[model samples]
Target: MEMEKTTDPTSFHGAYRMTPATFDELLALVGPHIVKQTTNFRDPVGVSERLGITLRYLATDMSQRDVARHFCVGRATVCKIIQEVCQAIWEVGAPLFMAKPTTEDWKKIAEEFNNQWNFPHCLGAVDGKHIHIQKPALSGSLYFNYKRTFSTILMGVADAAYRFIYLDVGSYGREHDGSVFAQSTFGKALEDGTLLLPQSPNGDLPYVFVGDEAFPLKPQLMRPYPGKNLSDKKKIFNYRLSRARRVVENAFGIMVSKWRILRQPIIAKPEKVDKIVKAIGVLHNFMREKEGLEVECDVGSESGMTDVQIRLGANMYSGAAWDIRENFANHFSSPQGSLPYQNDIVQRGLNI
Candidate 1:
């Protein structure tokens, strides 16, 4: 028995098979009925098998040749299969994931921020993160960012419930958050007031968005004051702001974790990166909805309160009157004072 360790060719092939969940999700998106069947000598392979092979490759990080060899097809066939599957996933799931938040939705989000994070009169948190991508064949320098790394910008706005309202991709890796945002459609909407903020009982409660210190401070944009003399009020404000802002980080975590494809270096050309980014976002939304984890926000019909009433309520709390800046200064100067820990840092550090 010790001398006879035989390997079966079929056993090696079985290990490359796609999981049932992956196969079913793909078939559900692109029906098995419509998938082309192999027949003629010119036909490379069966659509179902090609799709399965593509899933296996993406899910396992296997090379194209590995997938091709497993499916007994050429590497070109594997490439085509990946493109087709990616396109299919995008077409079937895009609408399900990237929905525009309604007025009522915004209202609900505002409530969550106020209740959960103590950040009042906020509709959503906005920020940008980098997703590494293979360098473009034609314009390598365009996508490079200040970090000196090659990555595509993933700019998104998320509600307190962690639901993404808007997302943008395709920016060159070289752009900074502010620079990339300035050129984005969402940014333009914000500047033009087309993307209206929710009206609170306190005269639109002066809707504010939270971001990191890298972004400039403005009436609409709130960042922590960097100084000594950190007072209790400022510390509380920063703590609450950090809490609500973490939804975006959680969203990104779920995305990369579920789709390990994002964990590895994206080897596709820059031109195809947009599709890849969109496909992942769409998939993220779809999965969230399917799992019934989608957070519902009430943007309007505060059925609960009228806009004027909400504005009046917000006016009652003069956040500025709390001397937030003084509090911030005190906290930074204290030996024991510290910034809130971001989930991305805590979790990612552990993983590394």
Candidate 2:
């Protein structure tokens, strides 16, 4: 019997985090890559079973041994299957789901942020999350973080609809988001002016990615104003930026909420963990397209290395960067750019 016949549609979704039709579509895309040849000694597992096993492993926190038992397979087989299937998922699905955006795509993303989240000249929201993991052999304090956990960082750039546009995984957890970005491939591209970015709608102001206080304020990136402020204008800008930055947070939240494997420490080597993280991110975008699971509003409490500690990360900026931020702050408070509820939200003492 097929997996679908064994359960109802709701139960099927609960197990795989995708509807039956979505699973079939994903299988069609990913099956060819993961299919194995049958040997004369033993028959190969069916492609559907392989995909189902991988999805079950991701959808729940079940250990490999438990998953093996549930599927009536050996624990070693389950381990091998998950890694192979996750790699295939990333290779086959990433292009279709999370392809690199062009300059025009960046403009479209900014337009979506304005229409959906009310932030302008914002290409995307950037943030990082630590994927908890057990300490690696012979590695001490390298993966340890302020949260007192061993982890690998997964930094992502999220569009307004909570889809990941860019992702960098396998950074050590000890490094904060700002330093991680500074060292990331995306950061290097942005610094060297290779990454294609759309011009600002107003021309004078450049398009920027909104991040939390942990990120540096560059001409292309916007972080909130630090410390308690008295001026209502700064408060409005902070609130608006927070509202926009929340999309990345929600992206991470929805990923974790759907794929429970990230709910706890993933017991694997850092390299293996990298494949798993990338597969999860690619699958998230695929689900958004195939399953129509766009997150319209923020979900759960805030995450990432933002304001968790009393002292915020140092804000690295140049004079030009500061001027750009000031221009945005001024625009956010001005009549042309201001939202009617922005002032009220800031005045109501809500968390920005």
Candidate 3:
């Protein structure tokens, strides 16, 4: 309470990662569910306080005990409050922030990819990252990843605006992106052709999601051509695809940069961590949408450009998928579809 009274607006945002107005808006939405009944025994914690505690925990690496101290509450109470409030936030915010896109929505996303990323007919960018966690009890190697960390995988699809179109959490970290994606509900829908996507006019080329070498190349999914000795046209296609696909990477970057809880290893069970991760993802979309955030990709070392490679045999990608990729590659180098700066970027990549 003293801190609240004394802290300036910048300090408040640094603490909670949102403006007072935004906090009030969020409190109004999730307040009812988290509000406690005033019993004769004692008055319960206020809704604003409950939400504030949770936000501070997420925005920083503070432990529940530390958060409890900061909020003048018991550690056990802080734990319960964080869990309950996170669940309430997800329940209230997920539908609005993470709603599955319709055909029209997909079309708009593709249009944005074309306009902003210069990658036409691109629906979204897909990738997965390992989220570190404590090793679960009696679980041998289930959560252990190649990075030798006990973690879970967070697979996401981000549109050109860097908003997550879909998120799948809680996959075992031992699994790679491709395997996790292949097993995901969203991936299954895409494979089954049941996922809502905008129809192509000619019916020859379908809208595609740009991924990296870690993912399989499909008619619906486009990946960079594997190998160093690529032609200028293929290099241009790669540069364009990487430009678009980097949105997901930057989305993750912004999310982790803003919500520092994800940067440290979460000390919780896998089930609890799943809720926390989902809550964070939902909150990420909410903040990005409400804030009108910019999508900025890193201009760092080109070495950071390529994603983790898991060897996918050439035979795994169908001929039709190859043809689609070729078409995109050719178009990216053509006068009608080429960008003025694409060649320069491709050359820089090659020199690097």
Model 3: per-residue Cα lDDT over 264-352, one tens digit each: 78888998888888898898899987875633322221211123326456237899999999988888888998989878878887421
Predictions in order: lDDT? 0.59, 0.84, 0.83
Q: Candidate 1: which stretches are off by over 4 Å?
A: 1-26, 30-57, 292-352
Per-candidate TM-scores read 0.69, 0.94, 0.92
CA lDDT, candidate 2, residue 236: 86
| Candidate 1 structure quality by residue, lDDT tens digits, 231-260 | 454555555567667776666665654555
User: Which residue pairs does candidate 2 place in steric collision?
Assistant: none
* Top candidate (lDDT): 2
Deviation of model 2 at 217, angstroms: 1.0
Model 1 local distance difference test score:
0.59
Order of quality (lDDT): 2, 3, 1
**Best model number under TM-score:** 2
Residue-by-residue lDDT tens digits, candidate 2, 208-255: 888888888888899898879558888988888988999988888778
Question: Which of the two, 1 or 2, has more lDDT?
Answer: 2
